[model samples]
Target: MIIYDLACTAGHRFEACLGSMFDPNPDCGCGASTSRVPSRLNLGGAANAGPGRDDMPTTWHGTGQGDPATLKAWHGAMTKRERLEERYPELAGDRRPILAHEGAFAGRPLRAGDDLVPTVAKAAFGKEES
Candidate 1:
Protein backbone atom coordinates (compact mmCIF):
# COMPACT_ATOMS: atom_id res chain seq x y z
CA MET A 1 0.00 0.00 0.00
CA ILE A 2 1.07 3.57 -0.66
CA ILE A 3 0.14 6.63 1.41
CA TYR A 4 -0.46 10.02 -0.21
CA ASP A 5 -1.37 13.46 1.00
CA LEU A 6 -4.86 14.28 -0.30
CA ALA A 7 -6.61 17.60 -0.20
CA CYS A 8 -10.30 18.22 -0.85
CA THR A 9 -12.02 21.21 -2.46
CA ALA A 10 -12.99 22.45 0.97
CA GLY A 11 -9.29 22.63 1.95
CA HIS A 12 -9.53 19.57 4.18
CA ARG A 13 -6.28 17.64 3.74
CA PHE A 14 -5.44 14.14 4.98
CA GLU A 15 -3.55 10.95 4.26
CA ALA A 16 -4.94 8.06 2.18
CA CYS A 17 -3.80 4.60 1.22
CA LEU A 18 -3.86 2.87 -2.18
CA GLY A 19 -3.66 -0.90 -2.51
CA SER A 20 -1.26 -0.52 -5.42
CA MET A 21 -0.04 1.92 -8.03
CA PHE A 22 -3.26 1.27 -10.02
CA ASP A 23 -5.75 1.02 -7.16
CA PRO A 24 -8.67 3.40 -7.32
CA ASN A 25 -11.04 4.99 -4.75
CA PRO A 26 -8.34 7.37 -3.54
CA ASP A 27 -10.05 10.37 -1.95
CA CYS A 28 -9.86 13.00 0.72
CA GLY A 29 -10.86 12.26 4.34
CA CYS A 30 -13.48 15.03 4.35
CA GLY A 31 -16.88 14.05 5.77
CA ALA A 32 -18.38 14.60 2.29
CA SER A 33 -16.27 11.68 0.96
CA THR A 34 -14.70 13.40 -2.01
CA SER A 35 -12.20 11.79 -4.37
CA ARG A 36 -8.54 12.33 -3.46
CA VAL A 37 -5.73 13.40 -5.76
CA PRO A 38 -2.11 12.42 -5.34
CA SER A 39 -0.45 15.61 -4.16
CA ARG A 40 2.98 14.11 -3.52
CA LEU A 41 4.87 10.79 -3.23
CA ASN A 42 7.88 9.36 -1.37
CA LEU A 43 10.11 7.72 -3.98
CA GLY A 44 13.36 9.00 -2.41
CA GLY A 45 14.25 10.80 -5.70
CA ALA A 46 14.68 7.47 -7.48
CA ALA A 47 11.75 8.36 -9.73
CA ASN A 48 13.54 11.52 -10.87
CA ALA A 49 17.18 10.54 -11.35
CA GLY A 50 19.37 7.53 -12.22
CA PRO A 51 21.31 5.57 -9.61
CA GLY A 52 24.61 6.83 -8.01
CA ARG A 53 23.51 10.48 -7.95
CA ASP A 54 25.49 12.63 -5.53
CA ASP A 55 22.34 14.47 -4.40
CA MET A 56 20.19 11.53 -3.30
CA PRO A 57 17.11 12.37 -1.27
CA THR A 58 17.14 11.49 2.41
CA THR A 59 14.43 9.24 3.89
CA TRP A 60 14.63 10.72 7.41
CA HIS A 61 13.18 14.03 6.24
CA GLY A 62 9.63 14.81 7.41
CA THR A 63 6.71 14.52 5.00
CA GLY A 64 3.18 15.91 4.65
CA GLN A 65 3.28 19.34 6.20
CA GLY A 66 0.01 20.82 7.48
CA ASP A 67 -1.91 23.85 6.17
CA PRO A 68 -0.47 27.12 7.47
CA ALA A 69 -3.88 28.75 7.84
CA THR A 70 -5.17 26.08 10.19
CA LEU A 71 -2.05 26.34 12.35
CA LYS A 72 -2.25 30.15 12.43
CA ALA A 73 -5.90 30.08 13.42
CA TRP A 74 -5.18 27.71 16.29
CA HIS A 75 -2.33 29.88 17.57
CA GLY A 76 -4.43 33.05 17.28
CA ALA A 77 -7.27 31.49 19.23
CA MET A 78 -4.98 30.49 22.11
CA THR A 79 -3.27 33.88 22.19
CA LYS A 80 -6.59 35.74 22.23
CA ARG A 81 -7.88 33.66 25.12
CA GLU A 82 -4.71 34.18 27.12
CA ARG A 83 -4.80 37.94 26.55
CA LEU A 84 -8.46 38.09 27.56
CA GLU A 85 -7.79 36.31 30.85
CA GLU A 86 -4.88 38.58 31.62
CA ARG A 87 -6.86 41.72 30.91
CA TYR A 88 -10.01 40.71 32.76
CA PRO A 89 -9.40 39.01 36.10
CA GLU A 90 -13.13 38.85 36.86
CA LEU A 91 -13.91 36.94 33.67
CA ALA A 92 -10.94 34.64 34.24
CA GLY A 93 -12.20 33.92 37.76
CA ASP A 94 -15.39 32.45 36.28
CA ARG A 95 -14.50 30.40 33.20
CA ARG A 96 -17.35 27.88 33.29
CA PRO A 97 -19.96 30.40 32.13
CA ILE A 98 -17.76 31.64 29.31
CA LEU A 99 -16.91 28.15 28.14
CA ALA A 100 -20.52 26.94 28.26
CA HIS A 101 -21.81 29.93 26.34
CA GLU A 102 -19.05 29.75 23.76
CA GLY A 103 -19.53 26.01 23.30
CA ALA A 104 -23.21 26.53 22.57
CA PHE A 105 -22.46 29.22 20.03
CA ALA A 106 -19.77 27.14 18.36
CA GLY A 107 -22.23 24.39 17.55
CA ARG A 108 -23.76 26.63 14.91
CA PRO A 109 -22.06 27.16 11.55
CA LEU A 110 -21.26 30.49 9.83
CA ARG A 111 -21.52 32.39 13.08
CA ALA A 112 -19.22 34.97 14.64
CA GLY A 113 -17.74 35.00 18.14
CA ASP A 114 -18.50 31.28 18.44
CA ASP A 115 -14.92 30.12 18.78
CA LEU A 116 -12.40 30.97 21.52
CA VAL A 117 -11.30 34.18 19.78
CA PRO A 118 -14.75 35.71 19.60
CA THR A 119 -15.73 34.26 22.97
CA VAL A 120 -12.82 36.02 24.60
CA ALA A 121 -13.65 39.21 22.72
CA LYS A 122 -17.23 39.13 24.00
CA ALA A 123 -16.10 38.50 27.54
CA ALA A 124 -13.71 41.41 27.39
CA PHE A 125 -16.04 43.91 25.70
CA GLY A 126 -19.62 42.60 25.40
CA LYS A 127 -20.59 42.55 29.05
CA GLU A 128 -23.29 45.02 30.13
CA GLU A 129 -22.50 47.58 32.81
CA SER A 130 -24.03 46.91 36.25
Candidate 2:
Protein backbone atom coordinates (compact mmCIF):
# COMPACT_ATOMS: atom_id res chain seq x y z
CA MET A 1 0.00 0.00 0.00
CA ILE A 2 1.05 3.53 -0.70
CA ILE A 3 0.08 6.69 1.17
CA TYR A 4 -0.88 9.82 -0.73
CA ASP A 5 -2.38 13.20 0.04
CA LEU A 6 -5.80 13.76 -1.56
CA ALA A 7 -8.12 16.75 -1.99
CA CYS A 8 -11.88 16.62 -2.41
CA THR A 9 -13.90 18.85 -4.70
CA ALA A 10 -15.31 20.47 -1.55
CA GLY A 11 -11.78 21.64 -0.57
CA HIS A 12 -11.08 18.97 2.04
CA ARG A 13 -7.53 17.62 2.20
CA PHE A 14 -6.56 14.31 3.76
CA GLU A 15 -4.21 11.36 3.52
CA ALA A 16 -5.24 8.00 2.07
CA CYS A 17 -3.79 4.57 1.51
CA LEU A 18 -4.22 3.08 -1.96
CA GLY A 19 -3.85 -0.63 -2.68
CA SER A 20 -2.26 0.09 -6.07
CA MET A 21 -0.81 3.14 -7.80
CA PHE A 22 -3.60 3.06 -10.41
CA ASP A 23 -6.43 2.65 -7.92
CA PRO A 24 -9.50 4.94 -8.28
CA ASN A 25 -9.89 7.98 -6.05
CA PRO A 26 -11.56 7.40 -2.70
CA ASP A 27 -14.58 9.28 -1.40
CA CYS A 28 -14.17 12.03 1.13
CA GLY A 29 -16.10 12.43 4.43
CA CYS A 30 -18.70 14.58 2.66
CA GLY A 31 -19.24 11.86 0.01
CA ALA A 32 -17.33 13.90 -2.59
CA SER A 33 -14.70 12.29 -4.75
CA THR A 34 -11.08 13.02 -3.83
CA SER A 35 -8.20 13.36 -6.26
CA ARG A 36 -4.54 12.76 -5.50
CA VAL A 37 -2.63 15.96 -4.77
CA PRO A 38 1.02 16.54 -5.46
CA SER A 39 2.90 16.42 -2.16
CA ARG A 40 6.22 18.03 -1.34
CA LEU A 41 9.21 15.84 -0.51
CA ASN A 42 10.50 17.50 2.63
CA LEU A 43 13.83 16.21 3.86
CA GLY A 44 14.45 18.19 7.05
CA GLY A 45 17.19 20.80 7.44
CA ALA A 46 20.85 19.77 7.67
CA ALA A 47 23.19 20.49 10.57
CA ASN A 48 25.28 23.65 10.45
CA ALA A 49 28.85 22.89 9.30
CA GLY A 50 30.62 25.97 10.71
CA PRO A 51 30.02 29.19 12.67
CA GLY A 52 28.63 30.89 9.55
CA ARG A 53 25.20 30.17 8.00
CA ASP A 54 26.43 27.09 6.17
CA ASP A 55 24.69 23.71 5.77
CA MET A 56 26.34 20.29 5.72
CA PRO A 57 25.14 16.92 4.55
CA THR A 58 23.44 14.94 7.30
CA THR A 59 25.29 11.79 6.24
CA TRP A 60 28.78 10.94 5.11
CA HIS A 61 29.93 8.58 2.38
CA GLY A 62 32.87 6.12 2.03
CA THR A 63 35.40 5.62 4.85
CA GLY A 64 35.02 9.33 5.84
CA GLN A 65 38.81 9.77 5.90
CA GLY A 66 40.59 13.08 5.22
CA ASP A 67 43.95 14.77 5.67
CA PRO A 68 44.85 14.99 9.39
CA ALA A 69 45.57 18.73 9.38
CA THR A 70 42.47 19.66 7.36
CA LEU A 71 40.18 17.32 9.34
CA LYS A 72 41.53 18.68 12.66
CA ALA A 73 40.81 22.26 11.60
CA TRP A 74 37.31 21.38 10.34
CA HIS A 75 36.50 19.48 13.54
CA GLY A 76 37.69 22.40 15.68
CA ALA A 77 35.26 24.71 13.82
CA MET A 78 32.19 22.58 14.74
CA THR A 79 30.04 23.23 17.82
CA LYS A 80 30.42 21.10 20.95
CA ARG A 81 27.21 19.13 20.19
CA GLU A 82 28.21 18.68 16.58
CA ARG A 83 31.69 17.51 17.59
CA LEU A 84 30.20 14.99 20.04
CA GLU A 85 27.75 13.65 17.44
CA GLU A 86 30.42 13.51 14.73
CA ARG A 87 32.62 11.45 17.08
CA TYR A 88 29.71 9.20 18.31
CA PRO A 89 26.85 9.10 15.80
CA GLU A 90 25.21 6.13 17.50
CA LEU A 91 24.52 8.33 20.53
CA ALA A 92 22.86 11.12 18.53
CA GLY A 93 19.53 11.18 20.38
CA ASP A 94 20.54 9.50 23.63
CA ARG A 95 20.91 11.74 26.70
CA ARG A 96 22.55 9.24 29.08
CA PRO A 97 26.26 9.07 29.84
CA ILE A 98 28.23 6.58 27.75
CA LEU A 99 29.84 3.89 29.95
CA ALA A 100 32.86 1.83 29.03
CA HIS A 101 31.40 -1.26 30.73
CA GLU A 102 28.01 -2.76 31.63
CA GLY A 103 26.17 -1.15 34.53
CA ALA A 104 25.52 -2.92 37.87
CA PHE A 105 21.76 -2.65 37.24
CA ALA A 106 19.83 -2.77 34.00
CA GLY A 107 18.04 0.47 34.96
CA ARG A 108 17.58 2.82 37.88
CA PRO A 109 17.29 0.70 41.04
CA LEU A 110 13.96 2.26 41.98
CA ARG A 111 12.50 1.21 38.61
CA ALA A 112 14.49 -2.03 38.08
CA GLY A 113 11.44 -4.13 39.12
CA ASP A 114 13.80 -6.61 40.81
CA ASP A 115 14.79 -7.22 44.41
CA LEU A 116 17.85 -5.06 45.06
CA VAL A 117 20.72 -6.11 47.28
CA PRO A 118 20.58 -3.63 50.14
CA THR A 119 23.82 -1.96 51.21
CA VAL A 120 24.56 -1.30 54.87
CA ALA A 121 25.06 2.31 55.87
CA LYS A 122 28.15 2.85 57.98
CA ALA A 123 29.58 5.82 59.88
CA ALA A 124 32.40 7.72 58.13
CA PHE A 125 34.96 6.90 60.93
CA GLY A 126 33.40 3.63 62.05
CA LYS A 127 35.44 0.43 62.26
CA GLU A 128 35.50 -1.78 59.21
CA GLU A 129 33.16 -4.80 59.11
CA SER A 130 34.92 -8.09 59.80
Candidate 3:
Protein backbone atom coordinates (compact mmCIF):
# COMPACT_ATOMS: atom_id res chain seq x y z
CA MET A 1 0.00 0.00 0.00
CA ILE A 2 1.13 3.52 -0.83
CA ILE A 3 0.36 6.54 1.29
CA TYR A 4 -0.67 9.70 -0.49
CA ASP A 5 -1.52 13.16 0.72
CA LEU A 6 -5.19 14.05 0.22
CA ALA A 7 -7.29 17.13 0.70
CA CYS A 8 -10.97 17.78 0.62
CA THR A 9 -12.88 20.71 -0.90
CA ALA A 10 -13.45 22.10 2.60
CA GLY A 11 -9.65 22.60 3.03
CA HIS A 12 -9.07 19.60 5.24
CA ARG A 13 -5.89 17.60 4.62
CA PHE A 14 -5.11 14.00 5.48
CA GLU A 15 -3.37 10.87 4.27
CA ALA A 16 -4.57 7.47 3.14
CA CYS A 17 -3.05 4.21 2.05
CA LEU A 18 -4.23 2.93 -1.32
CA GLY A 19 -3.35 0.30 -3.84
CA SER A 20 -1.35 1.42 -6.87
CA MET A 21 -4.33 0.97 -9.21
CA PHE A 22 -6.98 2.12 -6.74
CA ASP A 23 -8.73 5.45 -7.04
CA PRO A 24 -6.86 8.29 -5.38
CA ASN A 25 -9.98 10.12 -4.34
CA PRO A 26 -11.09 9.52 -0.77
CA ASP A 27 -13.46 11.09 1.75
CA CYS A 28 -12.14 13.54 4.27
CA GLY A 29 -12.98 13.52 7.95
CA CYS A 30 -15.49 16.28 7.24
CA GLY A 31 -17.23 13.91 4.82
CA ALA A 32 -16.13 15.97 1.85
CA SER A 33 -14.61 14.26 -1.19
CA THR A 34 -10.82 14.45 -1.29
CA SER A 35 -8.25 14.66 -4.09
CA ARG A 36 -4.57 13.92 -4.29
CA VAL A 37 -2.23 16.68 -3.14
CA PRO A 38 1.43 17.25 -3.93
CA SER A 39 3.77 15.77 -1.32
CA ARG A 40 7.50 15.98 -0.68
CA LEU A 41 9.79 13.01 -1.13
CA ASN A 42 10.96 11.78 2.29
CA LEU A 43 14.46 10.30 2.37
CA GLY A 44 13.84 9.23 5.98
CA GLY A 45 15.68 10.41 9.12
CA ALA A 46 13.46 11.95 11.74
CA ALA A 47 9.96 13.37 12.03
CA ASN A 48 8.06 11.63 9.13
CA ALA A 49 8.65 14.31 6.45
CA GLY A 50 6.62 16.92 8.41
CA PRO A 51 3.26 17.84 6.79
CA GLY A 52 4.56 17.11 3.27
CA ARG A 53 4.89 20.75 2.26
CA ASP A 54 7.28 22.22 -0.29
CA ASP A 55 8.50 24.97 2.04
CA MET A 56 9.09 22.53 4.88
CA PRO A 57 12.04 20.16 5.02
CA THR A 58 11.69 16.38 4.78
CA THR A 59 14.65 15.51 7.00
CA TRP A 60 16.46 17.05 9.98
CA HIS A 61 20.07 16.03 10.60
CA GLY A 62 19.96 17.33 14.18
CA THR A 63 21.21 20.76 15.22
CA GLY A 64 24.99 20.25 14.93
CA GLN A 65 25.27 17.45 12.40
CA GLY A 66 24.20 18.87 9.03
CA ASP A 67 26.87 20.85 7.15
CA PRO A 68 30.50 20.95 8.28
CA ALA A 69 30.81 24.69 7.72
CA THR A 70 27.53 25.40 9.50
CA LEU A 71 28.62 23.30 12.45
CA LYS A 72 32.02 24.93 12.59
CA ALA A 73 30.50 28.42 12.54
CA TRP A 74 28.03 27.55 15.26
CA HIS A 75 30.57 25.79 17.51
CA GLY A 76 31.43 28.62 19.91
CA ALA A 77 28.68 30.95 18.73
CA MET A 78 25.47 28.99 19.38
CA THR A 79 24.21 26.30 21.69
CA LYS A 80 22.39 23.28 20.30
CA ARG A 81 19.04 24.65 21.43
CA GLU A 82 19.78 28.04 19.88
CA ARG A 83 20.72 26.46 16.56
CA LEU A 84 17.61 24.29 16.66
CA GLU A 85 15.34 27.28 17.20
CA GLU A 86 17.11 29.15 14.41
CA ARG A 87 16.58 26.30 11.95
CA TYR A 88 13.01 25.49 13.05
CA PRO A 89 11.30 28.68 14.08
CA GLU A 90 8.11 26.90 15.04
CA LEU A 91 9.99 25.32 17.92
CA ALA A 92 11.04 28.61 19.40
CA GLY A 93 10.60 28.82 23.20
CA ASP A 94 9.55 25.18 23.21
CA ARG A 95 11.10 23.33 26.16
CA ARG A 96 10.70 19.77 24.97
CA PRO A 97 13.37 17.37 23.80
CA ILE A 98 14.09 17.66 20.06
CA LEU A 99 14.67 13.93 19.90
CA ALA A 100 14.52 10.95 22.18
CA HIS A 101 17.59 10.84 24.41
CA GLU A 102 16.58 8.31 26.96
CA GLY A 103 19.34 8.29 29.55
CA ALA A 104 20.18 5.21 31.54
CA PHE A 105 17.43 4.34 34.00
CA ALA A 106 18.57 4.36 37.59
CA GLY A 107 17.54 2.12 40.48
CA ARG A 108 15.13 -0.76 39.86
CA PRO A 109 13.61 -1.53 36.48
CA LEU A 110 10.41 0.30 35.65
CA ARG A 111 7.22 -1.46 36.61
CA ALA A 112 4.02 -1.43 34.49
CA GLY A 113 2.67 1.77 36.14
CA ASP A 114 5.91 3.68 35.67
CA ASP A 115 6.06 6.48 33.08
CA LEU A 116 8.07 9.62 32.28
CA VAL A 117 5.11 12.04 32.43
CA PRO A 118 5.84 12.99 36.05
CA THR A 119 9.42 13.75 35.16
CA VAL A 120 8.27 16.16 32.45
CA ALA A 121 5.57 17.58 34.71
CA LYS A 122 8.06 18.20 37.47
CA ALA A 123 10.37 20.10 35.14
CA ALA A 124 7.48 22.09 33.73
CA PHE A 125 6.29 23.15 37.17
CA GLY A 126 9.79 23.79 38.53
CA LYS A 127 9.52 20.98 41.04
CA GLU A 128 12.68 19.06 41.73
CA GLU A 129 12.78 15.35 40.93
CA SER A 130 12.46 13.03 43.90
Candidate 4:
Protein backbone atom coordinates (compact mmCIF):
# COMPACT_ATOMS: atom_id res chain seq x y z
CA MET A 1 0.00 0.00 0.00
CA ILE A 2 1.05 3.62 -0.53
CA ILE A 3 0.22 6.70 1.49
CA TYR A 4 -0.66 9.92 -0.24
CA ASP A 5 -1.31 13.44 1.01
CA LEU A 6 -4.79 14.12 -0.21
CA ALA A 7 -6.64 17.45 -0.25
CA CYS A 8 -10.32 17.97 -0.82
CA THR A 9 -12.10 20.68 -2.78
CA ALA A 10 -12.87 22.25 0.60
CA GLY A 11 -9.09 22.63 1.16
CA HIS A 12 -8.88 19.93 3.78
CA ARG A 13 -5.58 17.99 3.73
CA PHE A 14 -5.34 14.45 4.96
CA GLU A 15 -3.60 11.16 4.42
CA ALA A 16 -5.02 8.46 2.17
CA CYS A 17 -4.08 4.80 1.80
CA LEU A 18 -4.03 3.24 -1.61
CA GLY A 19 -4.08 -0.52 -1.92
CA SER A 20 -2.47 -0.44 -5.32
CA MET A 21 -1.35 1.96 -8.01
CA PHE A 22 -4.92 2.19 -9.26
CA ASP A 23 -7.08 2.99 -6.30
CA PRO A 24 -10.35 4.06 -7.84
CA ASN A 25 -11.99 5.91 -4.95
CA PRO A 26 -9.73 7.58 -2.43
CA ASP A 27 -11.39 9.01 0.69
CA CYS A 28 -10.77 12.65 1.73
CA GLY A 29 -11.11 11.96 5.47
CA CYS A 30 -13.25 15.10 5.69
CA GLY A 31 -16.47 13.01 5.80
CA ALA A 32 -17.25 13.92 2.22
CA SER A 33 -16.86 10.77 0.13
CA THR A 34 -15.96 11.72 -3.42
CA SER A 35 -13.80 10.44 -6.25
CA ARG A 36 -12.07 13.76 -6.63
CA VAL A 37 -8.43 13.29 -5.58
CA PRO A 38 -6.77 16.69 -5.50
CA SER A 39 -3.22 15.67 -4.66
CA ARG A 40 -2.52 12.56 -6.72
CA LEU A 41 0.12 12.87 -9.44
CA ASN A 42 0.89 10.03 -11.82
CA LEU A 43 4.65 9.52 -11.55
CA GLY A 44 5.28 6.04 -12.91
CA GLY A 45 4.62 3.44 -15.61
CA ALA A 46 4.72 3.79 -19.41
CA ALA A 47 2.01 6.46 -19.46
CA ASN A 48 3.97 8.62 -17.08
CA ALA A 49 7.27 10.32 -18.01
CA GLY A 50 8.76 10.27 -14.52
CA PRO A 51 9.63 13.42 -12.56
CA GLY A 52 10.74 16.75 -14.05
CA ARG A 53 9.75 15.80 -17.56
CA ASP A 54 10.32 18.15 -20.51
CA ASP A 55 6.60 18.22 -21.19
CA MET A 56 6.23 20.56 -18.23
CA PRO A 57 6.50 24.28 -18.91
CA THR A 58 10.13 25.55 -18.87
CA THR A 59 9.35 29.26 -18.92
CA TRP A 60 9.53 29.62 -15.16
CA HIS A 61 13.17 28.55 -14.83
CA GLY A 62 14.45 29.74 -18.21
CA THR A 63 12.53 32.98 -18.77
CA GLY A 64 12.35 34.09 -15.09
CA GLN A 65 8.71 35.04 -15.53
CA GLY A 66 7.50 33.12 -12.48
CA ASP A 67 8.25 29.89 -10.64
CA PRO A 68 5.85 27.00 -10.53
CA ALA A 69 6.57 26.35 -6.85
CA THR A 70 5.63 29.92 -5.98
CA LEU A 71 2.50 29.69 -8.09
CA LYS A 72 1.50 26.47 -6.32
CA ALA A 73 2.13 28.04 -2.93
CA TRP A 74 0.00 31.03 -3.82
CA HIS A 75 -2.74 28.74 -5.07
CA GLY A 76 -2.65 26.77 -1.81
CA ALA A 77 -2.83 29.93 0.23
CA MET A 78 -5.77 31.17 -1.80
CA THR A 79 -7.53 27.86 -1.37
CA LYS A 80 -7.02 27.95 2.36
CA ARG A 81 -8.29 31.52 2.51
CA GLU A 82 -11.41 30.55 0.59
CA ARG A 83 -11.99 27.65 2.95
CA LEU A 84 -11.58 29.89 5.96
CA GLU A 85 -14.02 32.37 4.54
CA GLU A 86 -16.53 29.60 4.03
CA ARG A 87 -16.07 28.30 7.54
CA TYR A 88 -16.35 31.68 9.25
CA PRO A 89 -18.56 34.14 7.48
CA GLU A 90 -17.91 36.78 10.13
CA LEU A 91 -14.18 36.68 9.33
CA ALA A 92 -14.68 37.05 5.60
CA GLY A 93 -14.65 40.82 5.77
CA ASP A 94 -11.77 40.72 8.24
CA ARG A 95 -9.33 39.60 5.54
CA ARG A 96 -8.83 43.14 4.34
CA PRO A 97 -7.16 44.21 7.57
CA ILE A 98 -4.83 41.21 7.46
CA LEU A 99 -3.89 41.94 3.87
CA ALA A 100 -3.29 45.60 4.62
CA HIS A 101 -1.03 44.76 7.55
CA GLU A 102 0.92 42.07 5.70
CA GLY A 103 4.51 43.07 5.01
CA ALA A 104 4.21 42.16 1.34
CA PHE A 105 1.75 44.94 0.74
CA ALA A 106 3.08 47.46 3.19
CA GLY A 107 3.60 50.91 1.69
CA ARG A 108 1.80 49.92 -1.51
CA PRO A 109 -0.88 52.31 -2.59
CA LEU A 110 -4.42 50.98 -2.68
CA ARG A 111 -6.96 52.00 -5.33
CA ALA A 112 -9.96 53.21 -3.36
CA GLY A 113 -11.80 50.00 -2.35
CA ASP A 114 -9.40 47.62 -4.07
CA ASP A 115 -6.82 46.42 -1.56
CA LEU A 116 -6.20 42.84 -2.66
CA VAL A 117 -4.51 43.62 -5.95
CA PRO A 118 -1.32 44.91 -4.41
CA THR A 119 -1.05 41.97 -2.10
CA VAL A 120 -1.79 39.51 -4.90
CA ALA A 121 0.56 41.14 -7.39
CA LYS A 122 3.37 41.33 -4.88
CA ALA A 123 2.94 37.71 -3.98
CA ALA A 124 2.70 36.62 -7.59
CA PHE A 125 5.53 38.72 -9.05
CA GLY A 126 7.83 38.68 -6.02
CA LYS A 127 7.95 42.44 -6.18
CA GLU A 128 8.33 44.13 -2.86
CA GLU A 129 7.33 47.53 -4.23
CA SER A 130 4.39 46.53 -6.34
- CA lDDT, every prediction? 0.52, 0.59, 0.59, 0.56
Model 3, runs deviating above 4 Å: 41-130
TM-score on alpha carbons, each prediction: 0.24, 0.34, 0.30, 0.24
Residues 93-120, model 2: lDDT tens digits: 4444433223443233223322223311
For model 3, how does the per-residue alpha-carbon lDDT over 51-116 read when each residue is reduced to its tens digit? Answer: 212222234464334777755654534455456667888755344433333332232323344456
Alpha-carbon lDDT of model 1? 0.52
Q: Tell me the RMSD of model 2 versus the true structure.
A: 13.9
Error of 4 at 23 (Å): 0.9
Can you write out model 4's per-residue Cα lDDT over 19-116, one digit (the tens) per residue?
97688656566666544445666777464212222223456565346866766765566566567657767545423333243464466633345646
How many residue pairs collide in each prediction? Answer: 1, 0, 0, 0
Q: What's the CA error at residue 99 for candidate 4, in Å?
A: 75
- Ten consecutive residues with minimal summed lDDT in candidate 1? 48-57
Question: Any residue pairs clashing in model 1, and if so which?
Answer: 27-36
TM-score of 4: 0.24
lDDT comparison, 1 vs 4, better candidate: 4
Cα error of candidate 3 at position 118, Å: 77
